[model samples]
Target chain A: MECKLIRPADLDEALAAREQYTHDALPIAGGQSLLVMMRNRLVAPAALIDLEPIEALRGVEVSSAGISIGAMNTCRQLIASPVLGEEVGVLPVAARQVSSTAVRNLGTIGGNVCHNEPGADLPPALLALNARAAVRRRANAREVPLAEFFTGYFETVLEPDEILCRIDIEHPPAGAAGVYLKHAISPEDLAMVGVAAVVVPDGKQTGGVAEVRIGIGGAAPVPLRAARTEAALKGAVLDAETARAAGETAATEVDPPSDPHAGADYRRKMVSVFVRRALLQAARQIEENGHGAA
Target chain B: MALLELKVNGQEVRVEAPDTALLLDVLRERLALTGAKRGCETSHCGCCTVRVDGMAVHSCVVLAVRCEGKAIATVEGCGDGMELDRLQRLFLEHGAVQCGYCGPGMLMAAQALLEQNPAPTLDEVKKGLDGNLCRCTGYTPIFDAILAYGRGE
Candidate 1:
């Protein structure tokens, strides 16, 4: 990679360096995936703008509006952070499944989301959280919903001069319980089929399930919200039968591609299987929470 | 290549290599510290793992340029003076060093794991070393070694 090591102290400086350089230059944080791809010669950047020096780009804070996760925040930091954990426990829960502690310590959420890989563990949870990303280009900043961020396979809306600056997640959906489950061949391996489910009940589990939301990943081009499944589960009693039905509904809608990890048919089957697993997981969490509150 | 400055085992220095060159190559070639081996070019194998800024990372996939202004601990930095780190001793006691290609990275990973959780359970031990690939199927012995060390046995 043809390169210059640039450590800009602020967003402006970082943007300035990027504007002066070509698209071949990459904005780097954590370097867990970026450096690996570079070493593998999959990415040859002409320049690398290191993001660690910018202190403002490092933190996990909860405000009245939502939770703001800095771009430089590492996965390990997110997982171990009591502040982020309590503010948005789903993120911490998702972060725990991101490979080993070593990878988590060095891999940043911004990188994972920005890379826009469907198999990544964080994106499904982010999608379920209704997360949005703040992108910066020169003096301008705009927020893009996570669902709209991915344009195609391995592609994102990141402009040449822009960088993913932060992730903003609105307060937890009322009665929302989020769960992410994946089928992996082994530890440290990518998921064969991953599923994330978010259930937003009306209030306490006093009555029946009011509204439930679901997302499925590792079986599509991007993490997907199973509208059919959600429609099937809406207002239904959050019981074994309903949850199982939602899983089966999700399995029918997903169009999986054949990869070395799994065949398309197997992936489709896992969609149903994992959705059932995720829904049951979500239901148990909600039941336990209500029990604890009582 | 880019000129980068960083501390290795506590000393400061500057070096230049292909900006995309991995920290593993920098340590093994540029600085001539052969203690950290390159068993698998991919990060899946912890044979190239190292502690950077007190956290373990796959050096084989981390750019040397990114190592700038960070602290690096390689296998050479272990067993200072005359004594091996507790994890290293445990590996020897349990015969976990078969082929020895993955020894340095395993020890580094284990050291970081045990330091974080002195008394990790058997599951925790397995989880901690999940990044490593022991081709000899020597995982049980390694787990035993780390568990023994973890429990101070």
Candidate 2:
């Protein structure tokens, strides 16, 4: 299909394209994903609403609340944002591990999640922290919990006319410690199994477990919540034994998908391995690093 | 069709092409900057590496429209005549290049590494060039070339 390139300078111009062209128009932020898909013939639209001209969509703002990462912010930007990095180093650490320098410079964090690749690094990390995804539909804007944003494999709940304006990560929750671990088959391909674990300590705990959130992907169709693992460890004291149990629970709970990249067994096994490593990693980070989001 | 005005090497050229135009296409077809070759139309091969605003990116995967309002540097722009850039000269001196098809992309990738980290360790150099594939297995000299040039040692 023939397509036209449309550059939108403001929210009004972007919304105008949405109202008039609808599905034919897609908001292009960074163009790293859309351009590649278009080139590969996997995705084609009749028109593109390039968002880079909208300066409002470019800067990274850190506040007392958390980090508000703009839609057009590239991985390069995130890697260089000292404020965000110090507040949330997990983001840049994950961004740098995504692919390579060339790809990282072009790929945007918004595009990474917005594309909703099941094996993507940010989704699991974002979900692990319960990051809120802010979507703009015309004149209205709403924040959707990350868990609800993804509906299925290669699918998102985002309306065709709406665009993900930015991703609002809540200030590292008190005692929040996070890490992203994945089984990468190669430097270029997506994860065979990715696990992100964030531990939000339940302070004043007398006996057992600190609160923890574990998110695992590439094993399942959508990046999934490790509810069983979270349940097993919650209110229970975290020890080597408890961490081990949580890892096993995560592996057993998530229904891993099979593909050319990895078998179901491999993905499932990695669920146990990566989640455990991620948990321990997060635990160590909290203990050694002191409080997060200072 | 899309009308884009971009600075190729150092000169600004205006051209009308399809929205699907790759930076490689714009450089090779319209503005006559062909030093950046197109290897794999897909990004699997790094034959199309170029500097967009100073970081190396795959021109094959990059949209030409994105190049507008940004500085683009190709191997052709690095230096005049055969003098080449330091990395380029080092690559030849170290015998890093073989067959010469992947040379442009290799040089671009190496140049990016040196610019950001002039003293990358061997592992860092290896990590930096992970995206660029050299089919001839000429990596030893390539690694040596990058390390030597980056440190001026």
Q: In model 2, what is the error at residue A173, expressed in angstroms?
A: 2.8
Per-prediction DockQ comes to 0.64, 0.62
Candidate 1 stretches with Cα past 4 Å from truth are A204-207, A291-294, B1-3, B18-21, B81-83
Cα lDDT, model 2, residue B3:
86
TM-score of 1: 0.94
lDDT of 1 at A134: 94
Residue range A235-288, candidate 2, lDDT tens digits? 876656677778888989888888888889988888888887887777666666
lDDT, candidates in the order shown: 0.80, 0.80
lDDT of 2 at A186: 82
How well does candidate 1 reproduce the true complex, by DockQ?
A: 0.64
